[model samples]
Target: MLKKSDMIAMALGVVLGAAATVPAFAAGGGGDPPPPPTCAKGQVYSAKKNACVKAERGALPDEEMTQYAYALAKQDRFQEALNMLDLLENPNTPKALNYRGFATRKLGHTEEGISYYLKSVALDPNYAQVREYLGEAYVIQGKLDLANSQLATIKTICGTGCEEYEDLARAIEDSKL
Candidate 1:
């Protein structure tokens, strides 16, 4: 027979195991439903309706649009990402700027990307992801020192164990070769 403590431990383990399988984006907004699968161009996933919907200003919250733009960037749809970002009512947010920088950088305009990253950092200096991306842009420009500086800043915002730190560190290291 299982003791009460053992039963509780088993339940906790099950919950944690399920959580571990969840995609990272699921945590973007507190308890945001799992994002729907990728929608075609000019469409976006709507958590409210649990389906894809035509992308339009005011159709979804800015946060959701930003999340969708970020997803587009991750999928290598840089132009689509920028178009989605344009739909945001206010595109000056740190996350919006960061996504713009990411898409711009991936599109081979490193200088423009750096400018966006700087604006984002100015808005939210503690955003480690922006620091990482800024460092990467520096690496692309052969400015290892600047990249390293951003890496150090990222370390201060989030410890070396953070994904941003690890990714930037790897980018800096890879630049050396």
Candidate 2:
């Protein structure tokens, strides 16, 4: 009793319905697989081995860069730390800039050190340590006002008699004469 067009349309509807239902039935047996972890470019996932491998141009994380820079600085390898900072993809991270600045300061590169310190503070104004370092840098450069501003912030964050507080207080007193 059905017209040809109606039968054809009905057949197509059934086919489409089955097509949609088939995936639901197939998916019912097992829950969806966990999503793959995302990695930076130049990183590869080895499915057979179930591990991620770094490719030649892969970049390290900001935290790792800071740790490596600290290690190099501890070993008196300031230049190496600077080189590593230069290689980081996210070189502008506050920690990395702070480490680089600290290393440069230790190596007697005062201007470059202050530049990095300023950059670090600009990137993360809430970082108490960077503010302390900036204050110290200003003291070294004989800029009392700038140093006092930073020292006041450090004092507020660290409170009285903390190591940095004592140091900055002494520097401010010395700069007064």
Candidate 3:
């Protein structure tokens, strides 16, 4: 079995990878026009490599673009995720902001990620996933109390058995070990 920490990370990775099909985000909509058909399409921002590479492009809808960005983030290509996210018209939309936060934190910009997550939560207090992520980000920063507070918020939002509540609770439990 994977170590608990690895499980948490893996669970998150799986969630990110599968997020493209996650319907909860679909309920929210973005109307941003896609970037021009050249280098901007499907290119991710890679801060660690300090580079961006052109990828396939087409007439993908705004939702697909966001999903593409989330997929890039799942592969650890966070900067690319950033690049993809920029093409979104509704960047401030809670779902978009949530993915932006995911890519930001994955790339080591913890505070920036937290800012995005906070913005997402502010936009929609019912965003359990964002709260869970914000809590995990707090844990990474060694702020257990703050994470616990987020966990409490998530509990209020989704009760104790939902994915967000369980994930944050597991992260907190793992942190204590």
Expressed as tens digits, the lDDT of each residue in 34-147 for candidate 1 is 444679999998888988999999878999999888888889999999999999999999999999999999999999999999999999999888999999999999999999
Best by TM-score: 1
TM-score of 3: 0.67
lDDT of 2: 0.71
Name the candidate, 1 or 2, with the larger lDDT value: 1
Best of the two (2, 3) by TM-score:
3
lDDT of 2 by residue, 1-177 (tens): 999999999999999999997887654422323233433443433344466556322345555545555556656767766765676677788878888898999899888898998999899886776777778888888898988898788778778656567777787788778
Model 1 spans with C-alpha error above 4 angstroms: 1-36
Ranking of candidates on lDDT, top first = 1, 3, 2
Stretches > 4 Å off in candidate 3: 1-58
List the global CA lDDT of all models: 0.90, 0.71, 0.78
- Which candidate leads the pack in lDDT? 1
How well is each residue in 58-163 modelled by candidate 3, as lDDT tens digits? 3354666676687677677788888778877667888789999999999899999999999999999998889998999999999999999999998898799777
